[model samples]
Target: MDRHAPSTRCAVITPQLSKRAARAGSDRRSPEARLEEAVGLAAAIDLDVVFKGLVLLSEVKPATYLGSGKVEEIAGIVQAEEVGLVFVDAALSPVQQRNLEKAWSAKVVDRTALILEIFGSRARTKEGTLQVELAHLNYQRSRLVRSWTHLERQRGGFGFLGGPGETQIEADRRQIGERILRIERDLEQVKRTRALHRTSRKRVPYPVAALVGYTNAGKSTLFNRLTRAEVMAQDLLFATLDPTLRAVDLPHGTRVILSDTVGFISELPTQLVAAFRATLEEVIEADVILHVRDISHPDTEAQAADVRDVLTELGVDPEAGGRVVEVWNKIDLLPEDERDRMVNTAARADATDRPTLVSALTGEGADGLLDRIESLITAGRVMLTVTLPAEDGEGLGWLYRIGEVMEREIGEDGLMRASLRILPERVDLVKRRFGAAQVRTEV
Candidate 1:
C-alpha cells in the first residue's frame, strides 16, 4: 500500500571507487547489489527512479563529489529524463549537494536524506514524529552552510550589503533551534514515561522479547506470526516504523511481551539513532532479543553485521550468552538442499541458545523457536510450588498475574497446590505475600 501521496521522478547515482581498499569480513557484495539496494531505498519513499547508473570514481572531487565530465554527463541525463530529483547513493557534503543541484537543475538528496524522508513519512505516533523531526532538523542544520555569496551578506554592514536569503536563513536557523529544544523537552518526558511503564511491568512482570533485524528481513512478519497481530508486515523497506508491543503466549503457557521495532540498515545516520534513543530503550530492557535474519538473501552475513553494529550501539550484546538468539528466517524461499543445510547447521550448534531455522510465512519450525524463547526468557527464573487454601482467590489471582502457573491441583483438605515460574527478584515478595512456609523454590 502506498502511504506517500506525492511521487517524484528521480535519478539514482551510485559512485564507487575504481580500486577499493580491501576490507575484512564477508561483506564483498557486488556493485550491482549495492545499486539495487539503493534503488530500493529510493522506492521506499515512493520516488520513481527514471534513470539510474553506477559511476566509478578514481577520486572524489571536493566541490561536486563526481568528476566534472561525469557531472556534465549526469546533467544531460537529468535534463533528458526531466528528473525532478537526483539521489546520490553516497554521503554528500553541503557544498557538493548544492553544486550538484545547481549543475543538474534538480534537488539533490543523498542516501541519508532518502532514509530520513522514508522515516518522516512512516512515523505514526507522537514520539515517533518527534524523533523524526528532531533528526530531520539536526540533519538540516548541517546543510545551512553559506553556499551562495549573497547568503553570506550581513544586514547593516559597513558596505551596506545584505541578501534577503541571509535574513531568511537566520530566521530559519532560529526557528529550527527553538523546535529542537521543544522536541528535546518532549522526548525527555517520553523517556521518563517509558521508564515508568517498565517499572509498572515489573510489578506483574512478563518477560519481554524484542525483534530486531535488517530492513525488509521479515522482522515484522515474524512478529506478526508469533503475536498473531497484523502490524504492516510487507516486503517494502521500513514497513514497520513505530514500535509495537504485544503479549504472546509461549509453548509452555508462559506469556511474554513481544516488541517489534524499526528495522536497522547499513550506514544508519548517527543523528537518527540519537534521536530515536528513547524508542530503542525497549530493546535494552528486553529480557531476550530475537535477532531475525533473512538467510535467503545473498548478503545475509553482511546484513547481520550491520544489525549487530546497531545492537552494540544500543548496549545489547549479541554474542553474550543468553542475550540474543539468532533466528534464521525466510527458509521457505530457500531450495530444499539449502533448507536442510540450515537445519543441520542449527542442530549442530552446542551453545545454550543456538540459532533457530524457521519460516514465519508458513509457520514452519515455529514451535522450536517458541520453546527456545521460553527457555531464554526463564533462564534465571525460579520454579515454586505454593500450597494455599482453596478459598484464597486473591492469593491465586496474584500468583497468576505475577508468575506463570505451570500446574494447579486442589487437595481433599481444601488446599490448593500450584506450581509457578517466577523471576528471582520477585521470589522474596511472593514468599512474603504468601507465608514462606507455604512456598517451595527451585532453581
Candidate 2:
C-alpha cells in the first residue's frame, strides 16, 4: 500500500500457455491485451510495476510453471530492479509458486492471490470483510504446504505419548482447520441472513434489477446516474465490493429495486467464487440483469464474454429471453464522429437484442435506457381507473402499495377517483380485496 516505498516494486509475467487454444468467444483479445489487464490488476493495489513482459511457452513446466531459462531471466530482472514481488498472470500450483519464489528470491503471487489481496483491502462492510477473509483463508490453507515445511517433518514417538515436535504440525493444521471452521460458521449465518432478506423482498411488489459486468465497466457510474446516489464510482478495479441496493422509479412510475454487485473478471478465483456465492445470489434471483460494458475499452467484447461466463457459472443464462439487458457505457470518452458512428452501428444491429448506448458520466441517452427498462418491467400491466369513496383511505392506500398510481383526484361529491397501471396478476386481487363495484377499467 505504500506507493513511495521501493519494496512495493513488483514485476508481472504473463505466460502464454497455448497458441492454438483460445478463450471461449475471446479470440479477438490478443495476449498483449491480456497482459495489460494483468498489469492493471497489480496496479489496482498500488503495486509499483517496475517490470512486465510476456513469456511464450509451448509447454508449461511442472515445478516452476516457466522454463528454467525464463526463470533465470526473470530472476535477473528481479534482482536488478529490486522487485520484492513477482506476479504471474496465471493460476499457480503450490509447488510451482514455491519453486518460483526460491528461484527468483522474491515473494511470488499468482493472479488469484493478487485479486484476493485487492478484495481483502477494498472490503468495507462486515459481510464483505467476512466473505473476503473466508476466501483468503481457503487460499492460504492450500498454500500451507509450501509456506510451512515443518508440517512435513515427523516426530518420533509411540502412541499418545508422542514427542513435543509431533504436536507442532498437528497443532498448525488443527489451528488452520479450526479457523476455517469458524469462518465457515460465520459465513453460514451471513448466508442465512441474506436468504431471509431475499425472502422478505419477495413480499414487496418491486421488481429487482441487478447490474453486473466486467471490472471497471462503468457499472457504478451508471448506477449512480440512475439512482442519484453518490456511491464510490471510482475508475479503479473492484471499487465496489459489497452489493448496494436502491429503489429506482421507472418512467411509468413503477419502482424497481436496483442492485449493484461486484464486477466479474476472467478466470475468477475459485475460492472467491465459493465464498461469494451468497452475495451473488442477488443476480440469480433478479427479475432483470443489466450487463454493463465499457464500450471505450479495446477488449469490450471479450470482457462481456467473461462476464457472461461468470453469470453462467452462477446459474443464470445470459442469453435467456428478457433476462439480461446490455448497457454499453462510456460513449462520452469517444470523439464526436466516433461516438456517432458507434451509436449508429449499434442501431443497425439487430435492434431486438442490441445494447443501450449511454454515457453515464455525461447523462446522455439515460432516459431512453430507463424507458427500455420500464417497458420491460411493465410488459404485462394494464392501466385502470378506480373510484373509491373519499373516506375510503384503506382502498386508496392499497392501490398505491401494489400498483403505480398515475393520477388521483377527489370529486366534489366526496368520491375519490384514481388512475393506475397495475400488473395483470393483481387485477383479481384488487377486485376481491376492495369492492368490486368500486373499480373501473381503462386502457
Q: Report clashes for each candidate as comma-separated counts.
A: 0, 0
For candidate 1, what is the TM-score? 0.93
Candidate 2 on 1-443: residue-level lDDT in tens?
A: 55566548899999986656444454557889989999989888989899999998877789999999999999999999999999999899988998899999999999999999999888988889988988887887777552344544454567674564556756766787898899889878888888888776665567889999999999899999999998899888898999999999888687889999998988889999998888888999998899999999988888988888899898899987577889889998888898889888878867557789999999998999888888877777888878888888888888887888888999898888889888888888888876678778785
Best by TM-score: 1
Model 1 is weakest, by summed lDDT over 10 consecutive residues, at: 19-28
Q: Which candidate has the highest lDDT of all?
A: 1
What does each candidate score in C-alpha RMSD?
2.7, 2.8
TM-scores for all candidates? Answer: 0.93, 0.92
- Candidate 2's displacement at residue 128, Å, is 0.8
Q: After TM-score superposition, what is the CA distance of residue 370 in candidate 1 from its true location, in Å?
A: 0.9
Q: Which stretches of candidate 2 lie over 4 Å from their true place?
A: 2-7, 20-28, 146-170, 335-337
Where does model 1 exceed 4 Å of error?
A: 1-6, 18-28, 148-167
